[model samples]
Target chain A: MNEILKFFVNQDRMLGRNERNLMYTLKYNLKDSRAIADNKLFAKRIFKKNKLPIAKTLGVIRKKEDIESFDWSKLPESFVLKPNKGYAGGGIIVVYGEDKLHSKEGNRVWVKQNGVKIYQSDLEKHIIDILDNKYSLGGTKDKAFFEERLKLLKEFKLLTYKGIPDVRVIVFNKIPVMAMMRLPTVASSGKANITIGAIGVGIDIGSGVTTGGVYFNKPIEIHPDTKSKIVGFRVPYWDQILEISTKAQIASGLGLAGVDIALCRDHGPTILEINARPGLGIQIANNDSLKERLERVRKLKFKSIKHSIKLAKDLFGGEIEEEIEEITGKTVIGRYVNMNVEVRKKNLTVLAKVDTGADSTSIDSSLAREFGLLNSFDEFMEYYKTQKHESKNIESYHLESILDFANYRGIARVNNGNGTSIRPRFEVTIKIGNVKKKTIVNVIGREELKFQCIIGERDLNDFLVDVEKKI
Target chain B: MESFIQTAFVSNPTLFYYLLLIPVISSIIAMGRNVVGVKSYGFQTPMLIVFAFLNGSGGIEGSLFLIFVYLISFFLKTYTKSFNLHYLPRIAVIVSLISVIFLIYFMFFFKLVNISSISPIEMVIYISISEIFITSMFKSTGNKVAFLMFFNTLILSILAYIVVLFIPQWFLLRYPEIDILFIFITIAFSRWKHLRFNEMIRFRSVINDMDKE
Candidate 1:
């Protein structure tokens, strides 16, 4: 009941879909400006005219006859085929490279990111589908275009699942309001739409370091597929991303727009597309309200895009959080100490190891059982014992049933010296000194270890771990 | 006697009553969007549909006619989508099919009723409205959403029709001063900046997250 009361305090600061259309899109985006943003071909031309970096368009197929007459051999090893008016990253095909095993000379076969082989006839059929308005926004007749695919950056290779990641910056009134880096996952089929299960990592405007991430509308600390840390990685070319996004918004004549930019290995940041009616999922990604940020800069004027970018960084930036942290001094804790943790509505003082090297917290399996945190896991294990399911075969059935129980967050893959192991994660509330935080902790068999619980770097944000202090 | 004829409109004031309801209709549409959070086609579409209801076949039949037109156009669009024709030609075919359906309905079905009650201009307005509905429906993201918006517009138009019919014509004719109150109503809507009713539920997660911080 108290939670319900707190929700209404910030209700007015959140923007809904209806209010976004009624206030921002309808008022700021004129018909001609929206048309420019809607058509990718025209928007790319505008970006090129303004000297912004964008992928080069090789050819456009407007009709079925164009498909038959087009030269397939002229295409490079890697290219992207997309509808000119596709929305939400729909109807896009990416060719990673040529199939060395299947292709000979003139009849070269290409391989998709998912390892599907694409022949010349398959490409022709796809072009015809695009021309027939299969992937176009509003189901209108659209043209199919071949574009140069940007090479993925080295830092992002392990972070992304099967495709290149892109940064989406929302530029409103010449100010880059908020930005998020979208990484495609295997579940999303390599598309960066958050609704389709891609990961959205929030970035700090003042600093380029990623602050947090949201996958499927829930805050996540690690990538589900790659098991790599999602937060704390600094985005490359932050200033250039903001500059190109703002310039693209101005060139398209849209007062409020979202510019999707990809970081290429050779070219730096390149514009992917501009959206007139951007989605509201960025708010969930950043755990911030767009209405508040938008309203803060609504009436302000800027002399230039650079000035506005600076203003945005100063006003809605990570420095504000650091300032608050400075005022409230962090608590000092030793490497090994006894911490108070709340379990099943009771306070239990447990010996915990403060380790800053680990990214997530983990508790011993026996300690978790004593605290009643393993009720659901124990039930699943009991069921597994009866079925005699092997460890490798438990992937499908174990996760589905365990996820149905309360407090079971998800699965976590831990890489150690021996090998990789999968563990079930649980949400627990722990108090270290004066700070109480609700964190996700993985359950592992730590009977041989000295301490029962290990506090990781994630839960040690408000604490200074003194290695030499004797507990 | 000419001066008396000019001032005599005050005594028999049917025209003044209708002219006064125009602002009333505009106010209803504005309030419906700003306060009640009902999105119809647009400001003009619903207003024109209301006028068509008042001037043509009473409110019920006019609404029924609109539903019939939308249903025909929606199904015809689905049927003809496979032809792979150009956009304009496909719309032309859908409109042509709709026209034939209208011709058959008017020629055979309404033979018993007084068809002369509806003016030729009103018939043209109704037909043009069908085209507008079809275009707007195609512009939506999906068929389900388009149908939902169409249903909302129909309901709002019917509500406006009821409001127009129930207001005492004699009272409006006598007190033309009451129409000035609608100006203040419009101003109130223009100044509305609070969260709408639908927004409370749509941003529930955002609100909770903010509270957590």
Candidate 2:
């Protein structure tokens, strides 16, 4: 702890809470925040005045009378309804074309991107709730506005699941400091909110390609549902995204601002919103401290927006990949390698296949029996079968004790050519050359397979695959 | 000059109470502003200063009456939904209601307290406290307003009471010019941009993240 404190003390570039408040009080005027923070309409007007590309506003409903007289049919097939003073992603409804499905009362239904059908009355009630400030930051009365729903760019559609993704860029002194692309997930319910389980991928400011990703604060490489690689996703129109974010920051007159930008299929990059006090989840996504970046650009003067963007890309970009590589200390292995496998106090040298497609490592059950691991498995299975017949509510500790007696870690579901079945998992230390790692491997009946063990990608993080290397 | 100071302090020691009131109020406002980031409109400081003076003169009983007014006004403002009243009219109602409550309390408990007569200054202080309460209620929710108003008044009142009771009257009388030091204190507080003590805990992650880098 003292070392950590010393490290922070030595980091002169890090911005603390005191410095943030001082910056706001000294550099930002309170009146300027009113133009962007209090009401979204005023912010849109400012964006329009500055000639920044923003989502076209369809209408603003300030009162119940406005909602009653408003023509709903005139709205586009797909649009977004949001509260003007809403914070985070609260009180936002995204409609994705009209559903042909019959409503309960046979009225017209609007289909959400998630496939939920909404009646016209439901939308009206939502609009009324917005007008009543149900989602406002402080419960002040707010206006409900309809905005053109930005079509997700083709590049992001594959990465996101049933939601539109947006990029959040933190700009200080008109220079982009750090940025994270928020991808909506099934868990986040089609809203790009990290707190609610959306994936936040760090973008390389220099290259605009995703360098890393985090889901629920844990580093992850693939989208949970799509199982597609999240890193190295080259964002389309990266320069335009930065330019619009910086322009929004300057237009809002906030010395430090979070600019949210989304790519529209037809309109290109559009400004979504400007946040005066953005959350700190971007730090977790980027695996970097914002304070250091903010302080680095504190005194630098930008001759133009293009110059500032270039300066930002030069200063804070391209280091995330190197930092990750240094931290993991990973080495490359091949598709087939000779390794010494140890299980239940016995070590056997065997040839193993490296398969990145598999989620977990698997070991042949015959090989396990040869090493005396099946004896404990039989003993545990006897106890488990007896307990299963006696009662359905088995204590977790008792189950853990059974696994401990059997020398197995836990159970996992394995899929092979035959079918999928549950198998007992055991802890195995595989030493490939001089590198040794203890990983959990499932014991399966793999008599027809050539290799006795197959190492999966989860255990392969410390080793990169050399596809052409022959063992 | 020394003789004049001695005579002035000896003749009217209560004047020192009013002089000390400025720092007490300014310190409270500055603490609230720096620590909590709450903004006060034009008259909050003057009203707090007046309340501090009243508390200094009338002691514990005056502090109790101020608290009673604050609580009653806060409750009335929160519970009375029928009067979705505008700003000025709502303040007028609250002020009148506080005055009525004070009148009833005075009529009943005048004998228990030693300070029986109400001065014009005291009347202004009561009205100002009521106005501040109403204005704060307008700006924030009931619980926050109640907590801030209650604590601000209680702290300033206790401080004023201590200064009145413990500080030697002769010290103030001899060095009346020492009161000017409050001006410098206020300026110093206004210019202080250091992190509040609580902010250190809030930003401890940034501090710890330094080690990771």
Candidate 3:
């Protein structure tokens, strides 16, 4: 299939119009890729303008003098030091949790990629390589920057090594057409780009939802390090995230573009940078091709950017998740609790739970007196024979209520022959993980059952129980 | 990397096999570069040299196989000359037919073919060089072109052979990052276009002619 796909892709006729567009001269519109190429500071400028959140830049260290005069003390404890014009993820040092490399006799220190470290010595030798502009645009001399390291939200800590979470939005004509949430992996050495082992989670365009993520070119449902389920997540500020990304398409002047957005605590979303020839991995992550989606979007010229955004939402929004599943032909295993049951007369140890949120624990009326606890004779018979009929038994079984607190309030007067006639609350010792907790579980006999415990908010706070985890 | 550093000196047979493929892919990408200006096939000439070195005949038996390939390609190229096809097609028909001819020739005339008989695919690879040569026919103009191209390729092949033979693991480590053409790659290719060596060498006679005039 791959060989066949490659063959068709290279075929002139088989290629689409968007692909044909790729062969032509890049456009001279707003957010032009060349402009982005000419200036790195434009990304910073855009972030600052919209009140979008971004990391605080300590200094743009250019030349030896800038490096010398810049207060090294102004550098935040555990800040991100990086090359300003340096290529992607290159010339960056992240010292997490008060990191200062030790020299002989431990003098208090400041370090750059140069000045120390032989690994960086190769980088300096490679600086000649970078200055020769082997890695830069036209081999021009470069500048570097120092900025505060970002605090990753709780969702990303275990999944990323040293890298912060960043979202790549493919904005076409001032509308976000596609997106991928890239998380750093150990192999990426804490960088979010997936080429080096970071995971790319496909986001559902219709809903600001995440589907199963991928790593090492294979689709995965969980983070390898954190063991967190990798799908159905609400990316923060859904509409605003899309709005800012769309706004960037107007800013960058590149008609076909990729906008990288990073989150800040104070600022909502900041533009990381703009990419002209954004990677096809976004297509892979989003589970759709840019050619097809962009084709739909590229149609219908709009008078204003607002109409274009509305059109984008109409055309590409809902179909994103479905298209992703179609392209990959795989099911996203969501973090859901499920079970299979054999419905019959069986000794099924129906695991039960209790919630103090309920006023009383109800049992099958047949066990009322069998466990040596007396109940009014008339009330027990009436409750078991006809459950829907509600009657007050203040003199008899006033303490116990037969009301089913499962969904909408209802009555369940269930009984089996083996159940105790006296419905006495049994002290159930349910073991969950390494922790043991005690609960009052009513031994109920019924035709069938779903969940044994309601586990309302009241009793849940004590054991810190996860209903998904069971013995 | 430690293991790669250790394997670097060994020159294993598998390394040669994998190394042989680099040229094949690079060849395809080189075609892409010339046609599309994608710059995907950076360092193409070196890659082709590497390919040829790894695939070339090594010893006396290997030489005899080479002779068989030459004999087969020569006959097919001649036999297919009357066909209406272009140079490449002519070469292709000849190359395909050469495989059968070599197999037949070996069966009738010699026991020198390896494993008591040359494998069909091996014969195909040997004959395929005729197609490469046919492409080269359009590569340049004037007398001594073929000879110049041939010798240049030969030297490159030898250098590629030495590199592949001595530092097989070095190429393996570095090879995956090949075919990456970024803004950086564009920057590099642009530089390569302005190269002075190829310009001076290719137009030496023209310069001499102009000087004489």
Candidate 4:
């Protein structure tokens, strides 16, 4: 036993296929649980029995005869046809929508995810091949089934290709260990497998926000196609994702499993499939080790699925925050925050946009008027209205003395994309989260926008921005 | 070494000549996959292909014959897939088509090669190799990937064949203890838990990123 422990300790942090299979997969997974996990239809039944949301089955083809007998016309406009025991996301054809020009009364045509047109005979041939064990783990006979293709959630519509992006949560002993959001890139041919060209973005176990990403086994900070920052993108329905994954792990009776859950625009978080042996690319995405994590939680017990999720979060959560602090020594703040704007020796709670793009802080004119900070600006604007068309030069206005108030600092030149104008600036103090900063802010009329205040770059010196956070 | 083996080991040493190559073949396949990261069909299949090459008319002729069978079987399999036949029966169709093609080739083209070096059983071995190609084709993602896997298997088999040919059998015949050493090598390869060299290259970014800390 000591030899075994020493052997494990001597192994590297990165897990290869052999170590993963010998240690975790073969050791923890039973034959019965593995059988269910290998078959997608059986796993879906288990998920359905546990009251989990899964894709609705459209049809099932058990044998070659069923291919000819089954009504191919009844398939929905957008459905996914997959082999029951397919591995690594193979032999799955996702029909995005219907082809209008090729559909007759009894015969219809559909478009694949790659924009290839499929006829009724083509669908039948695919099912026949699937039943012939074309995509099974070995050469065993298998079944083919069709399920409703999930609609992409609005949050991930831009992040994914034609397919829905799913989150793969590796659960062990009923505890969620690690997770990464598998995004479909164009190069992956609409499949979300990392071995193919999809992007894997690691999700913080505690906060459900993306921490880092791996594309083609290398760390990437932005989505290759979308060019949006990959880090700090908060995954929607995160708690429910963990809960469903844990429950699916227990339901399938697999001690160790990778539960894939896709976020549907209509059904919310839905279970896609479960794997007895999950891939280890997630380690590169998180820049961490799965072997160490699995060893840490191997003997852990939990009260319930929710309790297990809570325990998992507590054990491995917000690691990115600590890493950022270590590297930059700055507090991390989100894109939108509620800040305390000082008004007449009191604090007014104002929702502010933390924009690193702007150079200085700006406030809405209506908010400044209600707070009595724009009384001098009203008189100055009245004098500016009379001299607007008369004088093109700043010195011709002769209003420098009128613009001088106790808090009024100077005029700021502002460009609104089309033209430039001057706005009255003031000295103000504001508190963002826990930190307070004294800065100069320009008062502008921004009643049409969402926030009344926009915090700019100069006041955010002591912070690093998490682009997707909300406080 | 040849006289010593004939005098001490057995009366007919020619019968044991092919048996001595088994361990060397296993070692080549194991080390090729475990260290160099060359994926093939499996250990036994590639080893059998190497034996077939050694038994047939040299390595190059056997490789060319295997490639011909694969291309014919590949096209026949793709063409027969639209017939909606079951997997086994479809494979049978491809094998039968290959047999007919071979019968025609041997009838007209038998004079192009030395007839004494090629046996009818060796011809059967070359034809049956197409079955492996067809099964992998069914499981592969597409024709391009199936071709790639077949190409890799062919290359690995050719490597093993070259080792068996150029390396004098007298060496293994004299140093019979080397077979035991190869068996130990195979055993040691099974217990290897380190990351493969290809995986090291695959995960270079992750490894380098961690090394900085």
Q: In model 4, which runs have C-alpha deviations exceeding 4 angstroms? A: A1-11, A324-331, A337-351, A355-362, A365-443, A446-452, A455-471, B1-15, B60-138, B141-148, B162-180, B211-213
**How much native contact recovery, as a fraction, does model 3 achieve?**
0.00
Docking class of 3: incorrect
Taken over the whole model, the C-alpha lDDT of each candidate is 0.79, 0.71, 0.51, 0.81
Model 2 C-alpha lDDT per residue in residues B1-213, reported as the tens digit of each score: 777766666676767655655565565556555644443443354445445455444555556656777788777777554555544565678788878877787689878655445565665575567766655554343355446655655564455445545545566556556557756766776665555444444345445555565
TM-scores, chain B, all models: 0.84, 0.71, 0.49, 0.90
TM-score, model 4, chain B versus true chain B: 0.90
Instruction: Please write out the lDDT profile of model 1 over residues A217-268, one tens digit for every residue.
Output: 7778679999886666668898889888989988989989999999999899
Query: For residues A284-363, what per-residue lDDT tens digits would candidate 3 score against the true structure?
Result: 45544555576666655656656666766677666534443443443222222221111122122334444434433443
Docking class of 2: incorrect
Q: Candidate 3: where is the Cα deviation over 4 Å? A: A1-25, A28-33, A46-53, A97-135, A302-306, A319-471, B1-29, B32-213
**Across residues A394-418, which tens digit of lDDT does each residue of candidate 4 receive?**
5434654554355767678888796
Chain A accuracy as TM-score for every candidate: 0.70, 0.67, 0.63, 0.79
Ten residues in sequence with the least summed lDDT for candidate 2 chain B: B37-46
- List candidate 2 segments past 4 Å from native: A1-38, A46-58, A62-68, A71-168, A178-244, A250-254, A260-272, A275-292, A299-314, A317-360, A363-428, A431-471, B1-24, B35-180, B208-213
Q: CA RMSD for every model?
A: 11.1, 10.0, 21.4, 6.5
Model 2 per-residue lDDT tens digits across residues A1-471: 977668445443444344565665346636667457557889899999999998999998989899778877677768888889886677788989887556433345788876778787778877776765556776687889999999978877778887778999999889999999999888887778886788999887886767678897777878887777677667788899999999998989888888989888899989888887766668767766677688788889879998999998899877544544453354545689887988666888988999988988888777777776554555556665566555423554566544443566656766667786667777777888778888888877536778888888787766645455468
- Error of model 1, residue B75, in angstroms: 2.4
lDDT of 2 at B106: 65
lDDT for A115 (candidate 3): 36
| Higher-lDDT candidate of 1 and 3 | 1
